[model samples]
Target chain A: MSQLSGNTKWSVAKLKERSPVRWHERIGETSIFIISLASILLIMLMAIFILKEGLMVFINPSIRAEVNFRELFLKTVWQPISEVPKYSLLPLIAGTLKTSFVALLIALPLGMLAALFISECAPKWLSEFVKPTIELLAAIPSVVIGFFCLMKVASWLAHAYEIKWLHDALTPHRLNTLVGGIGISIAVVPITFTLCEEAFHGVPESYRAASIALGATKWQTALGVVIPTAMPGVIAAILLSFGRAWGETMIALMATGNAPLLDLNILHSVRTLAATVGAEMPEVVVGSSHYHVLFLIGTILLSISFTVNGLSQLAISSLRKKLTGG
Target chain B: MNANRRRFRLPKGSEASGLALTLLSAIATLIVLSMLAIILVDLGSGGYRKLSWEFLTKPPEQGMTGGGIFPAIFGTMFLVIIMTLMVMPVGVLTAIYLNEYAPKHALITRLIRTSISNLAGVPSIVYGMFGLSFFILFLGRRIDSLIGAELLFGQPCLLWAAATLSILTLPVAVTATEEALAAIPEELRLASYALGATKWQTIWRVVFPKAMGGILTGAILTVSRGAAEVAPLLFTGVAYYLPQLPLSPTSQFMHLGYHIYVMATQSPDVEATMPLQYATALVLLALTFLLNLIAILIRVRLRIIAGEV
Candidate 1:
């Protein structure tokens, strides 16, 4: 009976010791959970506030009366300082599109060819050197690139092309959309090349060997088999580069002729939505229509970029599934 | 048929074409090299003749045309130091929470990750807006001085610039720190747990030290990026010219990034000292490049160490 009582006492002591420890662990875990949740909530709150403030510009009839929504959408003029103050987005949109498309046109072939050269044609040592050097380009600041373009590339283009028509089109200012496009191409090429190279390298060596054993040339095997398999990744790279080009501000602000006019010619000066926001947001008076309009622009930019990024991510995942059959 | 097939084969191009292809790569390299070269040449022709000991030491004499970069340099250093202090703790702690403490299946974990990615996409100008609204206006405090009326400045302070930069760099620091933390092996954690160490203790003692090199690399990169940024500072408060040195933490000072921007674009006197603008650009570029090199070096060293271990 005494031994049984002693055993009961021991069991009680063990339970008492373990209960507090478990309680403390639970408390700690719960606190961490709350903190993490709070951080996320804060971000969501910021996004919601931005959207709410931005929408107010459209909802207020007094503000909307000043600038017709249709004209803003369809018209190409973007003079914000004139008597009428037309807010036509077409000129900016066209400028942005032209520059980005030209950039893609230049970067796409070069990036793919560079990827092919690095992954297939080059020696391993050369591959290692080239890969990191290309990545280093991504790390360089956009502002530095902008400075270089403003100082040198614009002048170089003027000298090289020397087209009388182009010169006439860009008489007063040296910087133009074409110069912006070329500068942006320099930035985008490295990123696309890196992604494409990785994708190409990811293709199994056995496939290449099989194509070669079937008597295909090295170039044929690469072009016919490797490039096809890596198409989705290459597309993803292109989309990513597109998004970056669209969102870029410093280079656009510095190099693009800040003329907010509706000219479609590549040699003419133009401005993008991002550059406008960067240039004007700092000086915008608090709670003014201009401030709300800037916010609206931000909202548009965010949504557009989000869509592009989402599409790229979706493409990448689907490609992964297709490749793995999973 | 075989004899005809051999006759129909295409001839190889001359070695000249191969040389041209190789030259194309060399030209790409030259693009980067020439930027450096142009900056050097411009600075050498303009600033090399003018730069003296006084240029480094003197205050602005007449709206930056006559003065050295003393105040701007001091201001930049001050802002960087304060920003580092503010960001390092919060960023590192948040990274620790994500990597070590948070549960894998939790929605909060996923949300934090998404928010970080989105935050990185947000332009620097947006951060300036946030700082103006929240820190300067809503808080009803002096937004310019380092310490404000609370202590040293006895007035509204310029330290708000540093605070603004801290937010600007937080995402970078968090992403980098998380990457570093993630690199630590699960086996290390398990061993620590098996030894009866607490989770916090294991993280503090084993994981943090191992991850320090990467974290430092991230910090360096963040600082470099912060140093180059100008648009946000225009709103946060960096003066074009400061007459006095930023001797105290409370004293307001000029910054090189802002100085360069103002000199290049907004300055009333551009013709006489346009070369000064180029020299400033060279300085900014060199600073950014040096920081990048340092960060890369640290990252490479850490990777080597990790591999050896």
Candidate 2:
């Protein structure tokens, strides 16, 4: 026993002594630590580089002489290729908000209810079938979703407009904001469904038990106890999905008719900030005010996404704390 | 209360509302599911006739209104292969560092977590802008200047596209890998340490092998995610129509998503290319779907092995 104890102490001493293995261990940890910082570095670089290029619209003397900050914000027209180029963000912002809000309006109720069903009401076999099906919806590429909207949904909506009541409700443009909103919702709903399902699942079983023991019906427990407990997570889900709809490019590019029309009617064809960048960035001359304006649009998009994501993260973390009581 | 009865009977009035709510939500789920079904069936039917062996193997002819998407397929594969190579190591290592090395509650740890979440949320179009400004113009120009090249590195090409894509998908790879790493029980790590193995040795020899399934899932998910992105690649390297494959890192390439986008929106005759668009979309969808299915299967197997399911 003494020998064993002495041997253990000697090994510990040896481990503490500087060795090649120790050197490798130090190198490995340090290398991984550096590698781990790559994400932060990339994000910083992205912000810096985008800001450098994007802010040129305001900072560069030549660019400002042509397209000033006031024109970008206040001017309604976005014609950048005419003899006297104009750079306005109002139409794009209006289009983006309209389409994304419409998408949320369509997606929120359906996604929340579907998630409620999958989480609380469905049988095991049924939930399993529904869950992956929704995930498959997510796996569909944005480009594909965009194509579907352009080809089928547009035609369907155009056809539906022949009916008097449907004509009153539906957009007449083949590729209108309404069609774009529906297309974006196809992409947004899956995310909303998945996240809301997770939120519902996160509700404690004991909470449900207590509600049930109080003679509450299943729906009453789900509504009165479970959903209230998971409200933050639900909000996070909706916010994240809204962020997704806002940032979506391919769907907006293909489905929204790419027209920068500042119109309130959902039937009017509209353009989005993201789609403008996607559609116009490839052709714009390098270092031109047009290019910088696109980058400015990108900067706006990045900030919006960051803010929304931060809000969602806050909601999620708060929910975690509330659930765990930590 | 009835004196004769021992058990209490619950009121049945609320059951109707419960059933009604269930029915309503079930309808919602049904609507969502039918949407997916409609998309798949429509695309499958529309593209079915055009999807042939010749269509898969040949190149486009007559201004892309009639042709196969072989170049797009090749380019997508090349892009994803390089992207997978770049992302897997950094992403897996970052995950390892987070799950195993970093001290809990450290500021650096929180920053990294926040950055990863934000990275995942940054719009894909913004990634395209960054790819153009940072990767192509700035870094590429610097490289060209250093190498005394005229325009090779300063132009949009495969390397920068792959690099941009790898960054965009980094969060996916990291999150998946972290989940896998966390799934590993604490006792296993304790056992490895108890064997007098160094931290590096245990991480390399024991932990890595055990985490292989998760790593593979991360890799596949990364590939699938990177392969489908069109916006970032648009300015980075993707070409509208590349007659030649991206034989070198500095060469521009074609992609299925970009192909579909251009064909549907910009083809000379959109009606003529409609079938081609649908076919290309189908191919892209199949690739991503297959990859996701594989990842899910691997995860399910891992869960089974870990006795979690």
User: Candidate 1 DockQ score?
Assistant: 0.25
Q: What TM-score goes with each of the models? A: 0.82, 0.95
Pairs of residues clashing in candidate 1: B144-B157, B144-B158, B145-B157, B145-B158, B145-B159, B146-B159
The digit string of per-residue lDDT tens for model 2 on A1-326 reads: 99999999998788778444577679879999999999999999999998888988888999989988689889899998899998999999999999998899999999999999999989998987788778778888899999999999999888777888766764467789999999999999999999999999999899999988977778888998989999999999988998899999999999999899998888889999999998889889999999999999988999999999999999999999999999
C-alpha lDDT of residue A35 in model 2: 98
Candidate 2 chain A weakest lDDT stretch, 10 residues? A15-24
Q: Which stretches of candidate 2 lie over 4 Å from their true place?
A: A1-21, A164-171, B1-13
* C-alpha lDDT of all candidate models, in order: 0.71, 0.91
Model 1 ranges off by over 4 Å:
A1-42, A82-84, A107-112, A160-172, A201-218, A319-325, B1-53, B101-106, B133-160, B244-253
**Local error of candidate 2 at residue A172 (angstroms):** 2.1
DockQ of 2: 0.69
**Which of the numbered candidates is closest to the native, going by highest TM-score?**
2
Q: What tens digits encode model 1's per-residue C-alpha lDDT throughout A213-261?
A: 8766666677778989888888878887787787777777778877776
